[model samples]
Target: MTAVHLADLLTLGARPAAGLLLSLTDRCPLACAHCSTDSTMASAQSPGGPFRALVSSFTPDCRPELILMSGGEPLLRPALVRELTASAATAGTGAALLTGMFFARGGGRLPPAVRRAVTGLAHLAASLDAEHEREVGRAEVFRALGAALDHVPHASLHLTAVPDAAGHAYLDGVIADVRRRFGTRVPMLVGAVRPTGRAARRVPVHPPAGRGATGRGATAPCEFAHWPVVDQGGTVYACTRQSLLRGGPAPAHLVLGHAARDTWRTLSERTLGDPLLRSVRTLGPVTTRERYGPPPAADGCATRPGTPDPCGSCLALDPATADATARQFATPGGRAVEHTVLALAAARPPHRLAAARGTLPRYADLVELGWTG
Candidate 1:
């Protein structure tokens, strides 16, 4: 199998139905304060049978091109990683994983089982940050990552960057250290800590200042709506937002289908053919809501004082509004509009796509590292 690079993930992420995100488990041994999933050793962990069934259902013609497995700590079940990646490979799908490197705490050595899991992957990414360092030293994490680079065809770092001075310095130091050690061979994807799960209070997430429901760039297509995310219980969602993964049935529009029941072909068709989803992908939630749904409320979820959240508006969509949205997209004109928006979004460069997806705009270029194109 060909190595899958960070650039490959970012580029493919921009297209609809090009990839899948499987949250293997909600359990993690670490207690990082900024944990978005609020994961811990005691967290809920579903059995792995459904996950294996879903991947096995994928045929070469119907499978997603990439399978991104993540969790509180996916490597906690190293054997599952090896099994799922092997299944994906049979269907011609490349697989990647994101782990917290908890096993590296003692001496940065990979357990025999963990080493076997890493060897079969197309890409392996480790998370590092101030919060993570409090549990596992940076040196230990790096040493483990260095060993992983040898086994996996491609490896990268997932770093968290806060907006303050301390956060900025930490990011710079880490990037430099990683460059000195691994050079440009490893790429990095830097994103701000979102206010979700346990990080909700610890991290300050302010909406873009002066941006309302119809603010500047409000109509940009939502590329994230492309990849479907499967949570621990095999429930599939259209968006990868962590908050949606919270244990409950997703809103009608966001819910795709259960992996145990739905085949890749069924989920892929819903991802592409659903009118409401198509609208969200073409014109962002804000524009979609305002154009078809009821007039926007001044205050709602994800909305702060004088600021509006497109995602918030999307989630709060009423049944009447949702129906209206579907009706609008069922028309010939609406389908044409969607096609135009997708064409423009596809023309964007990978770095720009990364930035648009809410990563720190300046640091987004790191995703293109080592890419000849």
Candidate 2:
């Protein structure tokens, strides 16, 4: 098997150079119990100036290939969305939005500039989970879908699920319902729910003892290690989870040395050389036990089958845990490359997963042995 390197993966177009998950604003109208960002009515304020600067700085810094705009609800700042999307497009970046579909129905009453900006986006991704449906309502979901379809030809549906007897059943039904509703018009992606933030507060964190959404009993590998996250405050982290785990700290501004020519180089080097970031770049496949075991108080902490710890497997809210997981998998050898390939390959639409048997085996072999047809 040939080992794939991060550099080669980016150049070959198998992976993006860096995937930027920018939080446009933290204001969402809904107050779902499972909200991962811990967003609420009070925390919905926008970091306008700092966010603008971060986006501006990001454009020239190797220009990430994929930029995902998200927040408590990104539609709140229609104008900013437009500006960010336009900037990304101008810089030749492929952009997407992670939204709750709350604004999709009314076209978000966006300002003229923001509307124009959204129209230019490559795609809009809407969240559809049981909780989302309960809070936002199905009618609103259709309305948002209609709005999105009217604007962007590519709108993806992101479905998050947990592992449990009843939860698994609900997930299966959700997948069916999504297919029945959107069909082939909207692409869909499913993932496990990470325990963190509001979700951690509301939902119990635990891993599925048997076959589960993240490739059955097999652990899902962290492929986002090389990616860097730039928050609204211009604070950069190695990944989104890291940014969240750190409580959203502001990163030091890039430095400029005495030599005029060295200014940009020095700043860029410093940005890339941060120790916290370096730690993230070195993360790898985190053991399930490490994440799920009881807190430090427990003696001989370990996870047992059929006894899932709700806090361990959920990374949706905790940026720090996410960063740690990424760092654990960022091995220098072929392991990281293999893990990434497997992760991407495992990400399939519901139609594919339903039709395909032995997908997990093929994915595992492809990662461990580099098998391809």
Candidate 3:
């Protein structure tokens, strides 16, 4: 099998239903302050049987082009990692893993089990940032990454920015160091860390300017709703807010299906054919609600008061609103409008998409590193 580069993964991620995300486990050894999942060693660990069953169901014709496995830390389940990698390969799907480098904390080298876990992966990515550095030193991560390159055909780094002078400086320093150490051989994907999970209280939230209104009433298309995410317990969600889809019940609009019961084909069909989702992908959450649903209540959002929130709008959608949206998009004009918006969004390069999605505009281009195209 060939290696899948960072650019390829990001491009695939932009297209609807082109990829799949599996949260192998939520348990993480590290206590990164900015962790989006608030994952800890004490986090609930679910059985891997449901995850295996879902991947095993992917046939060559129905498999996603790529599979990205993550968690509080994915390497904790090395044996399962190896198993899923092999399974995906058999169906001609390339698989990748993202780790927090907890295995490299005491490191001179990657643990034998961890090395075995990454053996057949198409790509390997390690998370490095100010918070991660506190638990796992930069030198230890670099050594593990060096050995990782030997096992996987391609590799990259995932960095999160804090959006202040010091935060931006940390990102700049790390980017320079990675380039100096690995040169152009390694690419990177940098995204702004949101005020979610453990970072909620620590990081201040900066709402997008004119977030509810995009000047001409146009909103940035939501690429997050494109790929389906299978949570640790087998429930599948349409967006990146998998945390919301856990515990109690997931929002009806975002719930795709459960992996324990649905196949890749079923999940993909619902993703592409769901009327409410189609509207969200094209018109965005705020626009979708404005155009088809009732107006948002003044007290709709407690966290982001007086702000027009795209996600909150989507979450608060009513059944009547969903029905109205379905009716509107069933027409030829609606279809044409949807196609045009998606085409325009798809034409953008990975770097531009990164910037549009809230990565620091200056460093977004780092994702295109080592790409000839």
lDDT of every predicted structure (CA atoms): 0.81, 0.48, 0.81
> Please, what are the lDDT tens digits per residue for candidate 2 over residues 238-342?
444532344533223111122212222333354344333332222222233345222332422134444322222322224454354345446554355545654
Ranking by TM-score: 3, 1, 2
Per-residue error at 212 for model 3, in Å? Answer: 11
**In model 2, where do residues sit more than 4 Å from their true spots?**
1-16, 44-46, 58-61, 104-117, 207-221, 242-373
Q: What overall lDDT, based on C-alpha atoms, would model 1 receive against the true structure?
A: 0.81
Q: lDDT tens digits, residues 175-251, model 3?
A: 99999999987888887776667876677755422113121122556667889998877788998666544434556
The stretch of ten residues in a row with the least summed lDDT in candidate 3 is: 208-217
TM-score against truth, every candidate: 0.93, 0.63, 0.93
Least well predicted 10-residue stretch by lDDT in candidate 2:
362-371
RMSD of 1: 2.8
Report residue 124 deviation for candidate 3 (angstroms).
1.3
